[model samples]
Target chain A: MNSPLLDVRDLVVRYGPVTAVDRLSFTLDAGETLALNGPSGCGKSSTALAVLRLRRPDGGKVRFEGRELTNLTERELRPLRPRMQPVFQDPYGSLSPRHRIRDAVAEPLKVQGTWNRTDGPARVAELLDRVGLDPSYGDRRPHELSGGQCQRAGIARALASRPQLLVLDEPVSALDASVRAGVLNLLSDLQDDLGLGYLFICHDRAVVRHFADRVVEMRDGRAVPA
Target chain B: MSSEALLSVRDLRVAFGPVEAVRGLSFDVRAREVFALVGESGAGKSLTARALLGMVPRGATTGGRVRLRGSADLAAERGRRITLVPQDALSALSPVHPVGDQLAAAVRSVRRLSRGQARARAVAALDRVGIPDAARRARAYPHEYSGGMRQRAVIAMATVNEPDVVVADEPTTALDEERREQVLRVLAEQREAVGAALVLVTHDLEVVREHADRVLVMYAGRAAEVGPSGHVLGRPRAPYTAGLLASLPQDGPRRHRLPALPGTPPAPDALGPGCAFAPRCPLATAPCRDHEPEARTVDGRLVACHHADDLSDPLREFV
Candidate 1:
């Protein structure tokens, strides 16, 4: 299926004597959303971390667009970090407290050295606008925005580097039900517009049914048949 | 309200300094029925639950009547007749002690049982909630059990006393569908077995539909709509209720843009002289902005919306 954008093969993550994720394998195609549904501590978050190489796995392989990423060093993985950005569960925790919304969205672009001094603010405004936030919100701090707005800013930051795949770990679980709907619609629209792949980890069944093209249910660190 | 309801809350108000977190909320929960309080984060659902448990924040002041089984003094009868199943089970449980000890302690508080009998009852409670090898698992600590299992243990503890009212606040929000269903079913079964009324506070409309016998939709710390689950959910009489149902994602086929309510719920302290939802209400008029809508009976349902007459059932697509 067009050489899946993010391919994980038999991924294993362990903590001390316990295996948090056991021999899990999955693939994501461009413009496709894959939801990992499970209860808490069913290894959903561990699997996401292992794929991004944020947490080193005990065994197995994680490939990004056909390149093996398991044995890669942190310095070596830095070049590919922008291509697979993360939108975490807690928007407040994931974002920096001191940075303004503009800087938060522009930080990724600055890291890639892609935008010039003159073009950075325009790109930040464009990104914020893309996520359904007013450009004026760029001046506000993270604490000033509501849970929904902060999450939108988080999405804008994830898209700043033009990532091909978004590893969203419970992105909407922190927001209210009404606010979550808007964010989900924004994610769906962004996927259609940018042809992005999503590894959505969620516990809400109704959300999985509505948002994901395919559902993988995790139980006791293994993917079980649904 | 039923004449012989188990728990009757009349004009319950919780105020933290100048802000009234729960403003004049009232409801009745019948024995063995699941009563769900549905709303957003700041809608006072949690606050109302806390008031019932007599655990409102230190500075918050609660007023009006909270009669449990005809007793007006809720604080005097907190643990004896009513108990809380907290949202975060991991924190709700003691980290250092075995789960069995904690459950036994809760059981011993209400019933005059021997230590051995309480422990046996604790194991039985754990078994009732579908925990495998309950006798062995009861010896495990909170951190040792899985999140779902910890929640089950919390449920076991809450119902062990056989209280007349069980207040479960967001019990399944942290669980997935399979585990959520498992915990929900276990709680329902346990409540039924014990002959207790369940006061469920959650933001999930789908769960409310599946489990609740009656529902109270709160907006800005007020009851926006109150009725049977089918009528309130199937035919939302209030604009805010209609908007909340419309905002949920459907089961299949993604819409281009979900129909979202434009703004956030008003802060408790910033509510003006009109309906708290009028600013975000699509059908808001001068009357809605100028005067607060009092609760009125319409078609056998209690609704607090000035434009309730113009609003129609918005759950046709939802169901």
Candidate 2:
């Protein structure tokens, strides 16, 4: 049988003496969304960070594309880093304030040695257009865009690496209701087209119920049974 | 529903140079009622909330009257008769002082009370808001309290003197769902215990639907609709109101895409000659673009839309 795109088994994360995530397990197939739903201090974010290997888990395993990532050294995980990207809550804080939108989108390609000076600009524009931003927006900095527009640009940056998995932590919680709908629609469209797996961590129940294919209700660093 | 207004505002305008953030808006907050102001980010809800307290920023120009019980001088009774429950509890509170001392100081600022009497009142106020071991917790600094407990303490401080009105600006926006409900419940309880009118400014429609007795939907600094929460939200008469409600996720069969409002709210300086919402409105006609509609009674509610009568189920189009 074909394995899931991402698998987590009994993940545990510790911050000093505190156990932030405790024995959490979940799996996601390609083109599916799995939401970690909880309240504040419930360790939803810690699980996301552990799944991405941004924070090393104290116990258990994170398997991506049939390869365990928990035991990999930083040097060994370098190539695999491009296949998964994070879209954080604060859009403006995620992107460099000094960089233009086009340069921010182009940096991933340049770092991967796939950027040619001629077609790189066009690729950035294409990515912007794919996320519903106008190509002219490429010249503007992060401060010039609205909250919703900045989040779209952040998504454009995430897509630049051509990732198979996206870890979205409270992506729409900071936005207004109308703008949040537009961003959610954009995410749905992108998932449909690219077949990307999403580990959506959100505190809002309505949003989780509406957007996720399956949900793991969490409280106090443990998954509560539905 | 026919009670006299505790606070009345008419033709209120707040402008920064050439840009008018809130344009000729009007509303009333009746005694012991929850009046909500809801809109998008640039819709001027926060500015309107500040205007209620005569607290506009440094260079902004404020016009029109904000009368509390037939009195035009709001500054005279700022902390005594009206108070603000700000968005951030940490900033609202001083980190250096104990939580009880701050509440006591708020009481002593307006009323001539002895330190011991004010301290007693502060402990009582904290106890009323469900703080555990109020007297002990009251002596703890703001940083020592949890996020939710700090919020409860702020609510306690706002109600210690039992003002006539409480203006909470996005009080629960920073909290998670469980904590949001807890904070809102505490705020509502305090409003009831103090018998004060609540002017809640928020962008969460679900909160407005559950808590507000009456709601004012703002779009681009103008009132799009105003009525009882049940009528306005359950059966909206204005297209903008319908569109905002349609965008909310609900408990039903999940749709891959939401019926989102097409464009962003226009900046104040970029507004057109006619309806401020005309550029993004789906039902905009030539007249809607040519002339602005005034608030008029339609189906027991005040709706400022040319096509209010044309909408039976506006959500159908969005769906």
Candidate 3:
């Protein structure tokens, strides 16, 4: 049988003496969305960070594509880092203010040793267009774009990595309602086209209910039974 | 018109250099009523709220009149007759002073009260806002209190003066849904306890739907619609209001995609000669592009749209 794209088993995360995530378990298949629904300080973000190995889990197993990630060294995980990417809440903060949008999107490709001088600029423009941004936006800096446009640019940057899974932490919470729908629609279209697994973390229940395929309600670092 | 309104704002205009943020806005806030001003971020709702309090930023030119009880000197009556509950609760309070001490100072600022009497009133105000162990919690600094507690304390401080009007500018935007509801409930209760009108400026339509009695929908620094919240939200006459409502996710079966309004709000300095929302509006006609529609009463609501009368189902285009 084909395994799920991502499997998290009994995940436990700690910050010094405080327990942030306690015995959490969830699994996601390719092209499926699993939302961590909770209020603030409920460990939803900590779980996302641990899943991406941005913060090492104190005790748990993060199995991605049939590989155990918790025991892997930083050197071992470097090659696999592009497979899962994180889209943070603050769009402006995620992208460098000084860098142009094209450079920001192309940085991933260059770092992963896939950049060619011939077609690299074209690829960045393609990525920008794929995420519903105008190709001309690539020349502008993060501050030059609106909140929604910046978020779209951030998504374009994430897509440049050609990731299999995305850990979106309150991706649209900072955007206005009118702009948020467009971003959500773009994300849905990308997931269908790319078959990307999503770990969607959000506090708004209506958004979670509308966007997620399956949901795990969390409170105080523990999953509450639905 | 002047006799019934607790606070009447007429032809309000605020300009920063050549850019006019709020232009030709008018509304009346009745006594003990919840009047909500809702729109997108750059729709000038916040600027309108600041103008009502006579607190527009430095070097900004303001025109028109804001009269409270027939008095145009809003600066003199700011803290005593009307007060503000700001968005950031922590910044509204002093980090060094105890939460209760700040409330006492607010009370003592307007009234000539003894220190002991002011302190007693401060504790009582905290107790009224559902803060547990009000006396002890009052002694804690702003940083010591939780986010929710600090918000409730600010609400208490805003109402402690017993002002005739309280303007809350996106009071609960930073909170989650549960905490948002709790803080809004506290604000509502305090406003009721003090018998003061509330001018709530927010981008959250759900909050306005549940809390407001009357709502003013703004678009591009102009009123798109204004009426009873039930009438306006239920059967919106303006296309801008309808489009905004259609974009919200509901509590039923999930749709594949939300009908979002395309494009962004125009820059304040970049407005065209026609209606502000004409470019993005779905039902825009040639006349809509050539002429700016004036607000007129239709079916017990004020709507500024060239096609307000013809729209049978405003939500139809979106759905």
RMSD per model, one decimal? 2.6, 1.3, 1.1
Cα lDDT of model 3 by residue, A130-184, tens digit: 9888999998999889899999999998888899999999999998898898898
Deviation of model 1 at B215, angstroms? 0.6
Docking quality (DockQ) for each candidate: 0.60, 0.76, 0.69
**Model 1 local distance difference test score:** 0.89
Q: Clashes in model 1: which pairs?
A: none
Q: Which stretches of candidate 1 lie over 4 Å from their true place?
A: A57-61, A220-223, B111-120, B130-144, B314-319
Ranking by DockQ: 2, 3, 1
| lDDT for position A50 in model 3 | 97
Deviation from native of the Cα of residue B74 in model 3, angstroms: 1.4
All candidates' TM-scores?
Answer: 0.92, 0.98, 0.98
How many angstroms is the interface RMSD of candidate 3? Answer: 1.4
Docking model 3 quality class: medium
Q: Which one wins by DockQ: 1 or 3?
A: 3
